[model samples]
Target: MSEYQKPLPIIEFQAQKEFWDGCKKHQLLIQKCRDCGEINRRSVRMLCPNCLSGNLEFIQASGKGKIYSFSTIMAYPPQGFQDDVPYVVAIIDLEEGTRFRSNIVDCDIDALKCDMDVEVVWEDITDEYALPKFRPLKQGS
Candidate 1:
């Protein structure tokens, strides 16, 4: 997101800061389950959902995933993004076995499909904020 699409000021807390920092570094860090070694998707919690264990750590992702599901958002986006309507907003299933909601950019939106290979792309919207987006990875061409 750019300043225009996201014209509204974003409220941030400690966790969000750390998360954006990771994206700036081009590393996808999500909470990992210490009990069964599962990746925590959605949002991080103090304990693992599978085991109720408070043992969790941040793990770097491979930055590779597949589109599990998505929707074409034809309506107006946040603010600066009004020009890019009819875009793909999708849930990516990372190879490490976690799903995250992210926008699919850098490709033709109409060509999007479920299970298409994708790679992470970080959009630094502001000095303190960055949004993680995904784009379909091209095969050997």
Candidate 2:
């Protein structure tokens, strides 16, 4: 692939390292609290939000979710994303009961709607990183 000009994730800690590593392998990972059984969508936190416990483990997510909300960017695109204007950014509510923000792709922007099913699609932007984006779920896999 060509050199990616977009900003990439800054992996500063171990949790972030594990998260990026999982993404590089096309695996969607979330943090599960060992103390309270709470699953956190963000892996950057050292303590569980539900329970103050540092005992957390990484678990692979199914990468299936529904669009909780979305917005179509029609103007003022961010730096390095000028070519990707009119894209859809969405908040996905994963089946595992956590939500995260990702871009929706491979579908018509006009056809987008809330509560629509979606699944993970990786963008292997570089040799060291593979970002997970979402797309409308196909009728049959």
Candidate 3:
């Protein structure tokens, strides 16, 4: 593929490293607290946000979700994203009970609706990185 011109994630810590690695392998990983069984969607914290325990593990997510909310960007596109105007960005509520933010692709923007079913689709932007975007679930899928 052509070089990815968009701003990439800054992986400055071990958790970030692991999270990005999982993404490269097409896996969506989230942190699970060992102490309280709480799932932390963000991977930056070393301690469990729910129980304040320094025990956490990465778990693969189901990657099936519904659109909690969304917005269609029609103007003032960010740097490196000028060609991708009129795209939909959404907050997805995953089946595993965690929320994730990603762009919605491969569907009509006017057809988007709240709570619409979606599933993960990877864009291998680089050899070492892949972005997990969401798309409307196909019929009977």
lDDT against the true structure, per candidate, is 0.79, 0.91, 0.90
Q: How many residue pairs clash in each candidate at the backbone level?
A: 4, 0, 0
Residue lDDT tens for model 1, 19-94 = 6678767678888877888777758576778788878778888879999999988896776667878788899999
Residue 44 shift from truth in candidate 3, angstroms? 3.5
TM-score of each: 0.80, 0.94, 0.94
The segments of candidate 1 whose C-alpha lies over 4 angstroms from its true place after superposition are 1-16, 76-81
Q: Indicate the residue-level lDDT of 43 in model 3.
A: 48
Arranged by lDDT with the best first, the candidates are 2, 3, 1
Which regions of candidate 2 fall more than 4 Å away from where they truly are? 41-43
lDDT of 2: 0.91
Enumerate residue pairs that collide in model 2: none
Give residue 6's error in model 1 in angstroms: 1.9
> Which residue pairs collide, candidate 1?
4-80, 5-79, 5-80, 5-81
